[model samples]
Target: MFHKILIANRGEIALRVLRAAKELGIQTVAVHSTADAEAMHVRLADESVCIGPPPSRDSYLNIHQIVAACEITGADAVHPGYGFLSENAKFADILDAHNITFIGPRADHIRVMGDKIEAKRTAKRLGIPVVPGSDGAVTEDAEAKRIAAEIGYPVIIKASAGGGGRGMKVARNEDDIDVALATARSEAGAAFGDDAVYIEKYLEKPRHIEVQVVGDGDGRAVHLGERDCSLQRRHQKVWEEANSPALNAADRSRIGMTVANAMADLKYAGAGTIEFLYENGEFYFIEMNTRLQVEHPVTEAITGIDLVHEQIRVASGAGLSVEQKDVQFNGHAIECRINAEDPKTFAPSPGTVSHFHTPGGLGVRVDSAVFSGYKIPPYYDSLIGKLIVHGSNRVECMMRLRRALGEFVVDGIKTTLPLFQDLVNSRDIANGDYDIHWLEKYLAKADT
Candidate 1:
């Protein structure tokens, strides 16, 4: 076990890692930007160092400053808690060269899975179902048109390096292909510095389901089941539930085993998620997220497992604490992403929180970094907290989530509280009959 570790990010995730390390008798050093000198994570960590300015390029995303902080603090390992450099292969290699442990997968694994084109090919070779589209990247408009025509109409152009729905566009016909391809490449270049784009058949109103799998280094892997993340806006997930309402028990097992087999075949380690798109009872591989997802808490709620601790154990050469048969998914869990944004226009709202009142009761868990008088910064994501609820079944879970959302109170800034309140109360959500476009349609009705 590592005696000390450095956390290379900020916000609630940093605090989440800190709490876990402390429980395992490990000292934690937090590295923060100048904008987060007095942040909640910094206050809770055993020690802290200011890295750089507010801008992410000079601060959170700056690799050198984070490595220097680790050296200065004598940290034996670095735990990158999602985002920033968490999925950067070069950062993992740098830590390896410095003889410091990275509490995640191997650098090679990150490199292989980080590339969307390569991941799909690998999944196909492993016998996993993938959407029909271009074999790889399309460098010319002629090739793009050929691929789009072959795949039929209603195809999507996506960046080879893109995630979170950025650098993606849907073309319904041949006439729209040229503009869609050009726009996607430009956006990809701006966001990821790589303009490479690929084509795939777009499945309208698909359910975004992902399976969480953990590898125990020795080639053993198991799936903790799936998360239903179809409820999203701007390609960002807002609500996630465990044991997808769309999939039956047999199909769930099939998808889970398929993902586990793929991971074992690739020699993957630590924790990763194999995401898929479900449409008309068929599942197609989308991409794999190589780090802990923003929605992992819902899985933990049903499994009673500490994923952070398991990541550390795997990094330290330990095996997974549970096996496939030993893992049992019970009850239903739901999570609402509480963001600092306007419910109407969806604009970012960052400011000091005048008052904070969180819900507490059976099956309600809040993962947050804010408290009374805490100032929310504008330098990063708008996520202020996560409101999670669990119940014996889906119906109870929905009711519990509704009650919890009502109890949550944050003042002095706008939030998406009202949006979720209206969503959970809707009959569509109550019956689990919503598709990816349900929220958009719901909002349109409110406009009148």
Candidate 2:
């Protein structure tokens, strides 16, 4: 293991990595912007450095400043919790240039998985099922129209390098395809600097499921389990659960093995997630997240595995501690993302917390960075914390989550707590019979 590691992100995830490193007897260094000088992760780390000002471009996203901080702190390794530069292939190359260990997958692996179109092609070569889409990227309006007609109506135009619902559009007819294609391509170029867009048949009421796999740098890989993140808003996951009600034992085994085999063949390292869209008992490959997912806590709750530790061990040239047979799924786990946002208007509400109270007791976990007098900065993500609950069964997990949400209290800021509460109590969520659009439709009927 490295003598010391630098965490390249902020908020609860940074804190999460710190806890794991501490448990493994690894020293930690935190890099923060001036805006997050007093952040919880900074306070917990053995050493902290201010990379730059509040702007992400000059701070969290600035490679030079981060490299400088690592060198200054003498951190031999860097762990990017998630988001920001976690999946940036060039950043990984830079770390390689400096001879600093990047505690994630290799740069080449990231590059292949980062491009949606390329990932699809790779999946096909591996015999993994993929949603029928256009052959590579469409360069002309006429070509996009041809692909759309072949795929039939209600197709989705997605950016080759896009995620979080950006650079995506649904076109139900020929007239809409041209305009949607053009707009999607433009937005894709602006958001991800990739104007290459692909077309695919859009599934109505699809369930988003992903398998978590941890590989030992030496071609050995094992899957933890699958997470159902179907409950989303604008394609961004809002709620996630493990042991998806949508999948069966055989289904899980098949997908899990397929992902692990693919990684093993590619000699992929560390942790990554293979995301898929499931509908009508079939799974379609979407993309692979090359870093720890925001919903990882839920997977950990059910599997009793510390993904961070596994990541560290993998990076250190140690093999995975557990094998396929040793991996067992015990219970149902759920995670609700509590963001500092107006429940009615759905806008960010950044401010100081007058009072902060988190739920406690069995099977309830709160991963947050806020406390009394802590001010939420508007320069980054609005997520304040994650409310995760586990139980022997799905029903019990749901009940505990509802109770836990009620117990959480963060004053002087608007939160989606109320909105999540309404969701847990809804009939669709209770029966676990809803799809990705469930949350959007639920909010649409609200008096707001």
**Cα lDDT of all candidates, in order?**
0.91, 0.92
320-352: candidate 1 lDDT, tens digit per residue: 888899888889999899999999889999999
Which stretches in model 1 have alpha-carbon errors above 4 Å?
none
The stretch of ten residues in a row with the least summed lDDT in candidate 1 is 434-443
User: Where is model 2 poorest over a 10-residue stretch in terms of lDDT?
Assistant: 439-448
lDDT of 2 by residue, 130-173 (tens): 99888699878788888888878889999999998999999998
Q: Each model's TM-score?
A: 0.98, 0.98
